[model samples]
Target chain A: MAQKTYAGVTVELTDEGYLVDKNQWNKEMAVEIAQENDITLTAKHFAVIEFLRDKVEKGETLTIRAIGKSGIVDIKGFYELFPGAPLKVATKISGLSKPVSCV
Target chain B: MTEKEEYPLKKVCIICAKGNLEDVYAACVMANGAVMEGIETKVFFTFFGLDAITKKQMNHLHTATVGNPAMRMPNGWAFPSVLGMLPGVEAGVSSIMKKQMEALDIPTIPEFLEMITAGGGELYACKLATDMFKLKKEDLSDEVKDIITVGEFYGLCGGQGTQIIFT
Candidate 1:
């Protein structure tokens, strides 16, 4: 396991930098993680993150198509919110494991 | 030994030459996958592959039930070639195939094109094939950026870490 400190809080992470313990994640760390990817999180981004966390908690699969249908954002808006591999970047900062979806 | 620097794929140029349901889906999946990975993606459709973007045909694609070596009955038995020749068998089997993919969260061909382009992937039709079939731009899905020549398509594939895939 890898470790990093964001906002004075050290947390376990995967080698790829996703949080190993979702509970260890906080809003401040989310902002720091987004910064690592050069993104500035906004209310819209947080809403998507909340949706992803809920979806994962329910033991559902993560897919771009599902997320597009999330009603929080359309496919294009989702891409714009988290550019450059939206799913990967979104999940990483959302305290979720890296998504294993192709579409 | 020192750790090697990672060199990720920077771009993908996919070419689809067939129009079968599986063929078109394969191209769509790969192109969309590349786009989701943040790689620059360009899809070129030629010959029957144009059916994937053709407005009247894109969503109505069918996989081959006859002469498909991997085909099997739902019970896991080898599909009989004779049964495949019956009317509606191909269509029935193709819909089943589509359902299977759908259950895996794969999008329909039209929706896949929308997702790909929404992520900044570019789609094009081959000029030679479009002309041979007498197809015009309006015949293709609105998601298609243009009908381009092979030379022009090749020009877009230029860049380091770019792969040209023919499926």
Candidate 2:
């Protein structure tokens, strides 16, 4: 685990950089992390991020196709916004743990 | 860290060349898994694998019970090869597998494709295979973005950390 400070709040992260205690997350931490990954938060990004957070709360499996059909953002728009790794980056910014389903 | 370990995996291209229900779903599951991990993912349907992407045939895909080493009876017994050759045995086995997957909450093939594509994963059909099978573009699921050649498949995987997995 690694420790990082955001907005004067110290938090734990996994070796892969996912948040350890999701309760420690806030919009400010999300913004900092997004900035670290070269993304600037926008209304569109928030829409997807908030949806991901909600899905986590409900214990739902998030898939690319599911997100695409969510009517939140189409698949093309998702890739355009997140670029390199949409699901990973979006979930990280949303303050979720690293996905265990993908192998 | 060594140079070899420094470069992170950036993309994954999975080539599905078999049409068997289990084989095609295995490719779909992996491709979907890659996308779930936030890796750029692409699945190429080639040869008989095209059956998975073809609209008319995708849902009708069947498990290959003949000589399948992994098949097992529900009673925790080994499924015999001789019995597997019975006329209805293949369908029975396929239905059993599908039921097991459903019990585990795994998505169906079309649903899996929907999930993968929604998550920003790319789907493609092989140009040669499509032509050889005389399949028109309309024959494939709308998720298939394009029909491309094997060289083009490798081209998409040209990035330093890109992985090409054949199934």
Candidate 3:
């Protein structure tokens, strides 16, 4: 892990750029991280990010199916939001660990 | 001196030839995994595997309890193959397997296909198998892009960093 600044707040991040401490996250830092992934945070993107952060906080496993059923967005929109690797990209921007689930 | 360069996986093509629930899921899990990684993925279901794409049968597949040497009881005792012939045993085993998969968030066969396609992956059925089974286009799940010959399947598989897997 390494220290980096996002939106003027310096935080710890993994080599892959995921946050080391989710508690250090904030909306402004998330905006910078999302920009790194070429995403411009919109209301819809924030919806999915908040959903993911909430699930992680509750110690629930993340799955594409769960997000699709989250009512915030369907699976397709989720992919469009994070394109390529939805769960991995979304979690990284949301200041969570890289997802390890195969599903 | 030259430096070695890495070639990340670019595409994956998977084929499921058996209808067993385990075999079908193996193919799907691999294909979906690739899709989730943003790699191009294509899956072909043939022969008994056609059941995986069969609209009515996709969600109700069963594994082979009789011939599978690895079959075991929940308590880890060796399962007697002869008992596999008993009424309701296979169905019971299959349901248990499905439940275990659900706990891991593995999607149903239909849902797996949906997830794959939703990520821009492709699914196909084998032409010969569909003909032998007397199945029409509508008989397969809508997620299937087409019923294609093995030759046609090969046509879609050649490229750098592409792998073809058979189950």
For all candidates, state DockQ relative to the true structure. 0.91, 0.33, 0.81
lDDT of each: 0.93, 0.84, 0.93
**Between candidates 1 and 3, the TM-score winner:** 1
lDDT-wise, the better of 2 and 3 is 3
Candidate 3 backbone collisions, by pair = none
Q: What is the DockQ of candidate 1?
A: 0.91
True contacts kept of each: 0.91, 0.32, 0.74
Encode model 1's per-residue lDDT on B15-88: one tens digit a residue.
99999998998999999999999999999999999999999998789988889889999899999899999999
User: What's every prediction's RMSD, in angstroms?
Assistant: 1.0, 3.3, 1.4
Can you write out model 1's per-residue Cα lDDT over A21-103, one digit (the tens) per residue?
Answer: 88888899999999999999999999999999999999998999998998999999999999999999999999889898777
Candidate 2 per-residue lDDT, tens place, B36-134, comes to 667889999999999999999888888866687877888878888999899998888888888887766677888888778877789999999999999
Please identify which of the two predictions, 2 or 3, would achieve the higher TM-score against the true structure. Answer: 3
Candidate 2 chain B lowest-lDDT run of ten: B1-10
The best candidate in terms of DockQ: 1
TM-score for each of the candidates: 0.98, 0.79, 0.97
Overall local distance difference test of candidate 2: 0.84
